[model samples]
Target: MSHTQTIPTRSSINPADTWDLTPLYRDLDAFEAEFSDAESQVNDLSSYRGKISLSPETLLSYLKAKDKQFLIIDRLYSYAFQTSDEDTANTQTQAMKNKTLSLYNRFFASIAWESPEILTLTPEILSDWYTKEPELTNYRHYLEDTLRQKAHTLSPREEEILSLSADMSYGPQTVFNMFNNADLRFPSIDDGNGNTVEVTHGRFISLMENPNRQVRKDAFEALYHTYDSYKNTLAAMYSSNVKKELFYTKARSYTSTMEAHLDCSNIPTKVYAQLIDTVHAFLPSMYRYVALRKKLLGVDELHMYDVYTPIIRYDSPYIPFDTAKEMVLEGLAPLGEDYLSLLKEGFDNRWIDIYENKGKRSGAYSTCVYGHHPYVLLNYQGNLDNVFTLAHEMGHSLHSCYTNRHQTYINSNYNIFVAEIASTCNEYILISHLLKKAETREEKAYLLNHLMDQFKGTLFRQTMFAEFEKITHEKEAKGEPLTCDTLCSIYSDLNKTYFGPDMIIDEEISMEWARIPHFYTPFYVYQYATGLSAAIAFGSRILSGEPSALDDYKKFLSGGCSMDCMDLLKSCGVDMTTSGPTSEALKVFDRYLTELESLF
Candidate 1:
């Protein structure tokens, strides 16, 4: 009989391997008590609805009360959702999560009049009121931001209707989440040894990294074929998500979904366009790298499955989790002792749920409540990429930790635009550190391959994803149908353009779009590209021991939503408005490619 590897159940995992949720709530009973109190607090917020602009005092009181209500609601939602994520198949926790979402919707509906009513207060009146109530100065930026959306602000009743429709709008994402995480299953394949291992969402990428080409090819085909079987349904789910964004875009009177999404962070549409244009200018560099990959692997054809495997062979492909942690700490030491101290704190405490369990959500993310510490979810497969993921998510967690400790609730949550910068900067630092510490030519080449892969994945690959989003969303906006064939065709063409003629664009790779969760959130993947550019800039400065580089970087992390994201990056001495950062980052990629080629 052959040995079969199976995912352990959640109950079977050691407590230390899981995140400690006790800070949010001691147990389900405590969560319910807070949930009940949150409902009453949300209802109480309705009492200030019509009187929002009556007086500055009334406005301040309402703002404070609303903030208080949200603090509780945030804790409740975080707890419920994290619990449900622990086991997506658990009906009880799913119900708990849904209940919190409903409470949030109710909270939104109750405060629907906030922006419109605030808009009624004239600039002079608000300025005068600010002096009368000095504390209102705290929300000056928040108030101005609301007023900035005056043209798009809907009527109170209409806003309430839209708020109530939140759950309906979220339906596609919810359904897709449940299907992808819980309902969908993949076939088992040989582990390239005598053992047979089951394919899973968490295991798919690890399988792709297998040294055996047959194993990589098998996992790729199996995973995509399963997704391909549900192509129509997945297409509909994606189409619905696009339509949902369109509905809100038109409702808010925005001309384009891209404009609408970018406007939330005050980012210019040209920033998006500039990224695409810049990446296009560097496609030859990407092609050169792809050719190098093909040459080194010495394969007749480079397929999508061949992309992830390490080009240079090195001992110990499997890094133990404990070793990964120490490596991350050492890699990030350049960020200073204070930063490392926090990373150590998270490690000592159960701030991370570190392994995959049956029915647990796939992939990794860092999330937090305002007053509590951040939590990270991971499906540790003991691969180098997983090690990078560990460092990546801890970057996010520590960013949140810094912002939460420094800013009030209103300003603590940074915009998604800047969110990736912190995460990717950590990755850049880690890769550089690994390269510097390499003991042999094989090790150096291996780390170089990993570094180049990071650039390929983050800069080139994410830009490709960004382009796909732009094309698909534009097509949908023009009333073209986003059927499975249309989407697959668009995605396939992008792969051809991005990977160049040297690489074979496999049919299974076309269905790759269906599996990307980021697509559900419009115009998001571009940040990964933009973020890499900014991160590389910052990483270079810090590694060179530039004066005030580390300090400026930490200040940016602590700034959160206190300033416009563009201004925040500008303060860190990286002006994202121009193409300098992206172009510079690609030059770094080119340099690495040259070094790697010389080694071979």
Candidate 2:
């Protein structure tokens, strides 16, 4: 992600760039027409109000019409937000984004009445509708889930009030983003010679991965020292967010806020709790990995920056975007020809915005709406990492494609718990493919190192984050003040335990939590660990051509939001409700560790 600052702004990027939104809509006028149609439909929602209970047919018509209306709103909001994230400085796009957020809020608020309205339906009537209409019966699961959230359901008016309170509710993410993105500045690192290089968030990880020991150490210290200066402010922002969760949880009649949050996705509280328990139980393995890192890196003591610096030899090679596209096709062939063909279509059809351009997004991700091909944003700079990133994002895109194609509009959107699976599966499949292509021992070891880094970051590091979040939330619930010292003490201790004793826990490591954007989003880290675990298990079986594994993997991608995540994975031969999937995946990690040692 380190850009050569010497080149001209947009001209520096590759000319073979793939992103052009013209295919989506001819121009602003076409999008405006769609926007107008959606607004008009929102205005027309009043017509179906009283007639909702008139008959099963009437109610179905209202819901169908409502779905279409909401889909339009979702598509508009999605496009705007995706665009905005790519470049925060574009004034026109920012205005469009703000308008889009406001409209989307209004759109959600407009429909807030429907849930409570539907909640009013007596069991007798709901049952009658189900029996009278088969399509209504198809939504039995949806209705039941809604009713399960009955206590959480505020009156329409209160829901509207809460919807309006979004800005205030978003104080944590907003404040943290500002501090992390705009306000905080790292100490300029002496990049050899007399010149100093400014450290940026996008470049932080890449710099940490630098082979130069001094560079890694300087970058790690400089970055955290910047965060340390604002630790108190960051702690306050985090406290506010935790309290927000507590308030919402208590406001809803759930036993705990964690349960309240997870219940919507039909995720059991045990899944979250089990991820913690399992990771905690396996602390020794993490410690052993740390010891190995210390030995392999040959550092007197490894610091936070040394952690990201590649321990094994890295054959850092450039992979062109076109070659990456073809590689993804071969890598993902296990998904079946139908899936591979769509993958090809997505590649050839300009579904991806390739190459780093001025004002383009910093990181990579896949986003698109129902009835549209999945869209990816990338600043692909012809690096091997970028190629793997392509595969990863495509996993998400293809997952979205399958779900959107198969499900009703209401069910088209899937949960984040399952979201990482498709993406990570693509990563695993890609690594397996690339490992075959490696012609040297160094190349093979480099891939293993990347694989371990992925596991350690997503699985182990996220578990650490999950622990930090759990500590803060519990402390907040007990009316404990989240002071800088208290927060840092808790976080730093976790760094020691998770990173194991061998890595030198520099003082700056304590400030690491302040920079994590995910901390604003509560109880969210556990999903990354669990999702990757499930993904590896599923992908491993499928790659080995296990009986029914491919079919099961397709079943999972096709589940959309219809089934709970655990049950969805159960169909894919991984029952994540138990800790078995994670432990099994960790066994694979252990095998990789063995491979890593063999390289030495």
Among the numbered candidates, top TM-score falls to: 1
Which residues of candidate 1, in runs, are more than 4 Å off?
Answer: none
TM-scores of all candidate predictions against the true structure: 0.99, 0.93
Model 2 misplaced stretches (Cα beyond 4 Å)? 1-18, 32-43, 122-124, 182-197, 356-361
Model 2 steric clash total: 1
Q: Tell me the tens digit of each residue's lDDT in model 1 across 122-236.
A: 7889899999999998888789888888999999999989998997888999999999999999999998887899999999988887889999999999999999999999999
In angstroms, the error of model 2 at 344 is 2.2
lDDT of 2 by residue, 1-600 (tens): 333342124545444465556655666677678877776666577776656767889878878887777778877887777666555556676666677667777676666676787888877889988888879865666776787778789887887677776656777876666456435656777664445676666566767877888888888888887777777788888888888888888766677767877887878889888887888777777777788888888878777777777777665766767788887888777888988888888887778877654455457878878887888887676766677789889889989988988887777788877888889888888888888888888788878878888888888999999888878888888888899999999988998888777777788888888877878877777888998898899899998889988888888888888766677778668988889989888888888878877878
**Could you tell me how far off, in angstroms, the CA of residue 454 lies in candidate 2 after the best superposition?**
1.4
Candidate closest to the true structure, highest lDDT: 1
Model 2, poorest ten-residue lDDT window? 1-10
